[model samples]
Target chain A: MAVALAALIQDPAAPPARHIAVGAASPIPAAACWLVRKAGANVRLSLLHKRRGNPFTEGTRELFDLAGQGRIDLFFLGGGQIDGQANINLIGTGDWPGSKVRFPGSFGSAFMYMMVPRTILFREEHSPRVFVPRVDIVSAPGISAPGVYRRGTAQALVTGKCVFGFDPARARFRLVSVHPGETAASVRAATGFDYDEPATVEDTPDPSAEQLALLRGAVCDEMLETYPEFCRRVWQREAQERVA
Target chain B: MDLLQLDALASLVLDGATVALPPDNSLPSCALVRALIRAGRKNLHLIGVPVSGYASDLLIGAGCVASIETSGVTLGEAGAAPRFVAALAAGTITVLDATCPAMHTMLQAAEKGVPFMPLRGIIGSDILAHRPDWKVIDNPFAPEIDPIVLLPALRPGFALFHAEMADTHGNVYVGRRRELATIAHASNRVLVTVEQVVDFDLLDDERLAPGTIGGAYVDHVAIAQRGAWPIGLPGCYDFDAAHFAEYARMARTDAGFQAYLQRYVYSDAALAAAE
Candidate 1:
């Protein structure tokens, strides 16, 4: 997942994102950002939760200021419920004020989604409950109406099962590729929203041995400052060695 | 301009006062929060700069907050803030859900003495749809451009937080956490709890001067060692993971939450006496 996200960050179609910001509770995106940086991409990373490598001294206020000023190039966001239109729901399900199921409040998802040019929607959980018909609440809209001064829109949606490329023109998600052991039919069945698919779907390419080596090496170490538990759980051997 | 006792400092915030707490993982004055809970401070309108976690949840569970204005409240890696989740589900407390930058921009408006601050994002979000207080206006600077959302200035009655250190003169060394400085600037009154009270002037030291909030902005200072206990204090310490996880677990039920309060908040005095 980190390798796939890294490829999106390094995609040639998008501008060379000089400044990338990763929000709190995002371990995979943080790893991908670090992996890209370690891969020799000259990018400045602003990790909101990082205690050691976070360059912002003023907390998330600096991140917001930079984003408002059009300084940030790339960002990552996730939602409790995402629909085919790319609308996301982070507030909760059921009614407003009194929700049946409550997720965490929308922190800066809407704000960053509008400001950053390449906002990647990454949610590891891929199921009908997550990919909804229409989100219960739109924390951030996937596409804005005409005349809205949004700098960007959803670039792509990366899930645990497959990757879906978003089309801003039509505001729809297109099946990009499925991960290993997953089929296009499985993705279609799990998803609640409608999307376009090709005649044949390809498996997401595996990261080269070199990329894997880099991810397990310096990238894992960089993740220690903010996401120690994630690193410990994912790269247990490397994390234990660091502790030792 | 010297350190006040915990109770004395806590008394500065009255019932029904709008209090501004620092963001998540920053310097939250847990000691002050305990003191407030002990005093039975009620009907508080908590303004979480952008986000809050334990402090807000503890207050809500104790029936202290009447309304809360913030983006979100969570334990981060630990998990969901149980009490807050319950409150929302019960509709017991009024929630003014805000986006992150909107909170900062509102506070910045107060800090700058402006009536309102206009922002670019949130036009198409459900947050704007829910907040009737927020307005969208045509960009007067460029009529050709789309409308922008304007948020009213957020001027809280009191700003409360914990810091790493403060000098006897009441100047606080917030270090790189400049949002604390902004909180002080925006609030009508500022009360700070510190882990240490140093004898030397913070401004005299070149390293700390730039990040220091002058005593003029600070109304009171209290020395509460590890004031952000359970919650981490940046360079000072790491969060008690076990404690937070326990809180997340125990706060799931009302009876369990009460037990937590009895153990931590009510027994604070006994724990302090033992010390």
Candidate 2:
């Protein structure tokens, strides 16, 4: 929610008609509510840094209503894998002991893919396991066909290494930019699919002056500075997981 | 006594047996299902399970159950799996809003021959109000009325289930979150129908699910192909869309439901087996 709050404040498309509703597979109502307010982004805020829980309560219906009524700006979803055109596949497997690990995920992925015009795909983990060739299942749709989007929806795929925005003209993921400390070749090598290696995938635009100002003054110091306990519980589990 | 023979799988439930049922929820289907439905007696109960489809509506209409004791979630009820909404509305089914775990606990108490089991972090105020049948005695220590909800045990004559595959000797392997465990614990006798009867050696470590119900617990098992009929397995067949919609429509009226039972369930067993 802190990051969502900050993302909203800094959004070039602030005061959006859709009101930047935060959709999650888990409950983060407070954080979701915070995104509507203007206080958080007063620094560079990254949503990935936060620890969250299972908020899965069929929240897809809310988004469905918004889409049916033509009231959506950007819906963000995190996936386990994404390909050239930003199609996601959250269902795991292609190997041994794989059947056991189907992460409970967005039941509305199919609906969202067809409806929400603009979607942001975030893959928290960046490795071969994700970033696959074609997905095991078509969890979300991207530029499946040219002019497929009757409404103007963009699906920007963000990974731990880089951020790739889609281009319907090519009907593939044209590199809009890369995150700090990433190279196009490394990302290309890691991908499971075939795509033209761009001459140079540009660096991801730095957080704007306004966004930075908001993050430092209003967001980082005032909020996230606290909540050490929630953060600890998460990383502690993660550490134990690593050891086990 | 171990009668879960492959050749007799179809005849086990359909040929003759008492059965307990959950309204609107489902267990896997078996191949000789149509014959079973035709041959099956009319004496059903509305217990609780997670999902229900055409088979449930047919069974209920067929009059295969006479009693009911329920506390389990339905498909479309609060925070439920969104599949069985229509069946719920059609009244061919019955369910109350409660967790499957709670239902299991209540039914298990019945199987263990208890009056009512007392313990809870549940019994929301709203749920307590609707269950007029449940009694609330004194808490004794608490000043307030006994805040606990008393779930009477449900001892069904027998429970039935279906699965992907089994062996000649009636070992059942179900997919995840299945009610097989609860069924095993709750029934006076248990019957099963499975897709294929694999060789005994095929029950490998990888193939076996964690909560495997023992043969000691199972009274009967029968092997059949396409056992999960009528109700499509998620990844298997495309659902029988027309049948579902038809059941939803017909189950609305008592006459329509009775007609359905006569045509689909209470027919001549000899003709049904031939058909």
Candidate 3:
């Protein structure tokens, strides 16, 4: 999943990303950014959660200032609920002031979604519940109406099941590819919003042997500083093997 | 330099005052929070710099906060902040939902002694729509450029936090957590609890001078060892994972939350009295 996300980030059609910033509590994105750096992409990787790796001395204030100045090329965001129009809800489920279920409050999701040119919406769980017809609350609307100053919107949404390419022009998602085990029909059944899809969907390319080795080796090691627990749970064997 | 008892330091915050707390996973002044809870402070408006977790939840659960202004309040790896979730769901406390940079920018304005700070990147968000205090206006410098949102300055009545060490001169050595310095400069009163008080001047060391905040900004200092317990102090200790897990488990319901307060908070008071 991290390798695939990295590939999306490195795609030439996207912005020539010179600098990428990963948010707090997002290990996968952090891993992806590290992988891109290891792959010799000439990208400046900034992980907000990293203890020693963070370049900013003043904290996230610098990150926000840079993004506002259009320095950040790619950023990642996730939501409790994401709708067809690309509206994300980080607030909670149900109405305002009276929510049925509450997730964490919107930290920088809305701000980064507006300022960063390419914001990828990545949610591991892709079900009817998560991909709603319309988010209960619009923490950050994917498509701003004319006259609202918005530099960007959702570029793509990568979930566990499949990757959906967002068309800002049409304001809809287009089925790109399904993961190894999942079928197109299964992806459709899981998603609640309407999207454009071809008759046949291709399988997302598996990571090359070199990519896997890099991920299991240097990438995993670099991730230890920010995501020690995650690395312990996922790449324990690789880390142990390196130690031996 | 003024050194006050924990009770007197906590009393610096009166009812209906807007207070700013540090962000999640930093030094949260846990000892001071307990003192406030014991003193029964009420109607306080709490501001979380970007995010808040344990301290915010504990205060809301204890009914000490009338309103909360923050990005999010979660216990991080321990999971949902149960008391905070319940408070929002029940609509018991007024919530002014804000994004991370918005809070920082507002506080930065206060630090700069500016009436308002113009920030980019909130023009299309629901956060901008919800905050009537935030305004979007055309750029005076470049009329052709896109409009930007301006955030009013957030001048907190008090900046309450915990640090690793403070010297006899009341200068705090916060190391790389410089945001604490910003919070102190932004607020009218800065009260800090530290693990220890040193006799030597902290600024005398060239290595630590850049990270040290001068005594002028700090109004009061108290020595409270393990002051940020449960919430980790950067280099001092790790978060009490088991205790946080227990908090997440027990704070699910109102009765359970109150029981938690009675056990940890008041019980500590009782133990202190006995001692």
Candidate 4:
């Protein structure tokens, strides 16, 4: 997922990520951003989760203020529920206040989704429950009407199973690629929504030798402080090892 | 400026007042929060600046909150705020869901002494549907039918936080967390707890002036060293992840949450251990 997200960050179809902001509890996206930066991209990264040397002194409000004026070129967002139309639900399931099951309330997605020019919808978990046909609530709509002051829409939706490129014009998602172990059929079965798929979908490219090396070396080092658990789980690197 | 004790500072917050607090990453005065819980304060409405974290969650777990208005509530890396979720599930508290910028915008409006302020996006979100106070209207300046959401001003009754230090002049040095300035500006009263009380005025330094909230806005200052303990003060201490993991583990159920309150929130020995 990190490799896939890194590729999307560098995708030339969208605006250059001159300044990208990553929000809290987003280790994978943070890792992907670090991967792209370490791989020689000229992107300025503002990581909100960075414990030290944080970029924003004015608080998270500064990040939003910058995005409001169209300074942040790219951002990453995820949802407890994402729909075929690219709508996301961070609020949770059930009634108005999510009485049955409450996911964390929507953070900055409501504004950032419209303020920033590009957003990559990422959720590592891929299944019928998550990739629902219709979201319980629209925390942020994927497509706004023509007159609405929307700067952008979801560029792409990357999941553990596959990648779905979003079309704002049609408010739909199209299957782009599947992971190595997964097939198009498997993706279709797991997905609750209907999406256009090619007859022969390509397998997501594995991270190259250089990319793998960078992910383990410098990226792990950069992430150790903010995401010790992720590093330990994915790269088998311990936080104490950095101290040692 | 006179420095008050922790309990005296906590006493300024009357029951059922709307209080604004920064999230865990920023400086949340956990020490003051503990004092409030111990005082058995109830029916408090908390605004999580833009979101909630350890301070908000602990307050919810102890049944001290009647309502919470914020973007989200979580323990960050540790996981979902178990007590907050449990309270919501049990229908114990009113949840006023808001997006991050909306909360910031509402407070910014209050800072400007405006009735409301316009914000882009949230037009199609259900959050707008729930927030009747948030109005949508055609952009008067637009040539076409451009729509925008207008959020009403939210001036919290009290703005509470922990800072690295406060000086004799009463200006609290927040460093980069200037959103606290917005909170201080918007709220009716500003209460701050600091790690130290220096003899000199903070505004004497040019570099520090931009980051410090003026003494004029601050209503009270209390000296509580390690005021943001458990949730660290930026540049002063790192957050205790082991403690957070332990709290998360113990806060999963009502009984466990009670046990946690007994051990940490009410127990002075545990508080001393944290020191």
Candidate 5:
């Protein structure tokens, strides 16, 4: 998933991601950013959750200020529910303020999704409940009206099952690739929203041997401080330096 | 510095006052939250600088909060904040759902003493729909339709937080977490709790001046060593992850939450830590 996300992050079709900001609690996306950096791309990563050396010195709003000024090139977003039009619902299920089931309220998704030039939507869970026909609420519209001053929209939606390229013009997702063990039919069965797909959909390319080495070694080293549990779970590695 | 006892400082936060609090990483005063709960303060409105954390959940669990205006409230790594979810479910608290930048923009407006501030993005969000005070207007400078959301200024009744240190001159050094400075600047009264009180003026020192909130804005500074304990201060200590994990478990049920309150908040350790 990290490698697939990295490929999307470095996608030539999208705007160049010179500067990327990863939000708190996003381990997979953070890993992908690190993988992109370790692969020798001259990318600057502003990790909001970095405990020791947080990139934002002026406080949390500095990141937003930079994005508003068109400094940040890319960001990653996920939703409790994401619809066909790319509308994400981080606000809960039933009513306003999530009367039924409240996912943690939208952090900065309503702003970041519109301000950043490009965003990659990633949700590890890709069930029918998550990939709904329409989100209960729009935390941020996948596609805004022409005069809404939106900088960009979702470049692609990457789930555990497949990779979907988002076309803002049509405001629809086209299946780009399916992960191993997931066929187009299986993806169709799981998804709630309708999408486009080719005759012969290919499997998502596996991470190269070099990519795996970097992810398990250097990337894990960089991530140990912020994401020890992720490293331990995915790489089966323990933190060398005890943080607490 | 007009240093007061932790309880006395907490007392200044009267019932039904709106208070701004920073999240866990930014230095929330857990000690003060406990003090407020102990005092039985009611109907306190909480404005999470942008987002909320454990402190907000604790207050809600203790029945100290009437409403919360924040982007979201979570325990971060520990997962969902149980009490906050319970209160929301029970319709006990009014939730003014906001995006992070919207809250910051509102606070910035107050800091600048402006009526409102224009912020980009959020024009199409449902969060904008719920916020009746927020207005959308075309950018006057732009020839085309460039609608932007204008947030009303938010000047809270009190800005409360914990810091590493404060000088006798009342200047509190927040280190790099200048969001606390924004809170102090935007709020009506600034009440801070510090781990220690220093003799030297913080603003006089070049290294610290950039991070210090001037004493003129600070109404009271109380010495509460490890005041942000369990949540922890930025450089001073690490958050008690085990404790947090346990709290997340205990707070799932009302009975468990009350047990946690007796063992932690109302315990002797809380008073000793605050003193």
Candidate 6:
């Protein structure tokens, strides 16, 4: 129950006058939604609507507001595939033939990469397959700083095991930090291409008691409680099947 | 909350609707299914967009009372679920079409309670034969409209959603325009479970979730947190992988399901949790 997001802050006390946190908010939008709840100051979300193909339908305007004013400072995203330059391919890479892989689409990754001052990319699976060097496509550019991108694009990358930085100097992704149990080699094993600096990745801090409490107790209880019903149809159905 | 008490909730589905899930999932500890089961109902169905990780598969298996199915793929991207894939491979279950975009149309149609939907001609090549359930019905009423492909509706008698929070009477917080609401709206009745009740104005004073679901639509309102487990509850916790995997394995066989129910569900634990 350690503080999963404390490290997300740059200056906890005198936080940057401006910043943004764009949450993926998928699988269960609530996962990223919870993170935004903690980092509320400069955060925006790319919410999936009740209907697909109807973009910007639900809260599209709010997203426009957050990015429109450069209110968001950081972007956090996670999916199945990520390549060097931080191009992500959540769409299929291996299984599909000419059709290729399919993702939830880029969602607001394209916009966030341009609008947010800093962006961080993370992967749930820190394996070699998911961590590619060059992505199949650019969901969002990692080092899209000036001339390269429309300027003002991604700044950093984070994963379950480590952290990475975008070196505007070299115009590429560079390993910045690693979590406690991870190693540079293991981290690289998951990544696809070569980033700039191989030597200087640091370690992410452990989750704090306060962070854990906030994560568990501070959520909106009304909605949080109903999740079991979701599983009842999925997990419990099978649980009962195994019994009778 | 203690997860062991979850089966109390699982025992509620109509008899045939019970789908023994894979062993690799968590068994919820609540009353959602308890109410469903006691009614001795069946004809369970599932159709929604997609969840990020394992929630969709988990729900497709457990939440469904009669048959386990969905409209989209969640194998990281667009594709059939492993259960569906393997079922198609072994011929345990009949797979209609492996296309996702087309299925999205079907889900949209079903959600809208429509007879058929016009697709993007994706079925012209390979998927038409794959899906025996779908039919190309011509529209005599409108000659301009492409001969329509009608996918049957997957209408679950009820849809259950877990939200960020809900007012005591049950208007879901629209933190995002979510697929859950669509599923609920598409179905006959909705059951809404939330994290907890704020003073209503105590949070979302502007009514962030104002029109998401009317109080009348939601049959019941539950207040709980860490409610979306094995499914992932945002910052609260990552998915419970071990539990999820365990459920997946146990549910691989029909006999295994009976054994599961006799052990965990029929016990006093389920009865107590229900109480």
lDDT value, residue A57 of candidate 3? 72
**Model 3: per-residue lDDT, tens digit, A1-244?**
7877898898889878899999877878888888888888899887776655357777567888889899999999988899998988888888763278888888888788988999988999989999999888878889886766778888899899998999999999999999999999999999999999999998989988988888788888887655666777777742234532
Which residue ranges in model 2 land beyond 4 Å of their true spot?
A: A1-244, B1-18, B22-26, B30-36, B50-53, B71-101, B110-115, B119-146, B201-211, B234-238, B250-275
Question: How well is each residue in A1-244 modelled by candidate 4, as lDDT tens digits?
Answer: 9999999999987778899999988999999999999999999999987878889877779999999999999999999999999999999887787866899899998999999999999999999999999999889998887788988989999999999999998899999999989999999999999899988999999999999999999899999888887899999998767521
* DockQ, ranked from best to worst: 4, 5, 1, 3, 6, 2
- In model 3, what is the error at residue B189, expressed in angstroms? 0.7
Task: Tell me the interface RMSD of every candidate, in Å.
Answer: 1.3, 19.6, 2.0, 1.0, 1.1, 12.3
lDDT of 1 by residue, A1-244 (tens): 9999999999899877899999978999999999999999899998897764457777569999999899999999989999999998888988774377888889998788989888999999999999999998888999899888899988899999999999999999999999998999999999999999999998888989988888888888788756767877888743335531
Deviation in Å, model 1, residue B208 alpha carbon: 0.9
Report the C-alpha displacement of residue B96, candidate 1, in angstroms.
0.6
Candidate 5: which docking quality band? medium
Clashing pairs in 5: none
DockQ for every model, please. 0.75, 0.02, 0.60, 0.84, 0.80, 0.05
Per-residue error at B38 for model 5, in Å? 1.0
Winning model by DockQ: 4
- In terms of docking quality, how is candidate 3 classified? medium
* Model 3 ranges off by over 4 Å: A51-53, A209-217, A232-244, B268-275
For candidate 5, what's the TM-score of chain A, rounded to 2 decimals? 0.97
Best model number under lDDT: 5
**How displaced is residue B40 in candidate 3, in Å?**
1.9
CA shift of A161, model 4, Å: 1.0
How do the residues A47-164 of candidate 5 rate in per-residue lDDT, one tens digit apiece? 9878778888898899999999999999999899999999999889987878789988899999999999899999999899999998888898998887888889999999999999
Scored against the true structure, residue A84 in model 4 reaches a CA lDDT of: 94
Error of 5 at A97 (Å): 1.7
The lDDT per prediction is: 0.87, 0.47, 0.84, 0.91, 0.91, 0.46
> For residues B66-107, what per-residue lDDT tens digits would candidate 2 score against the true structure?
433333222211122222222333443344433333455566
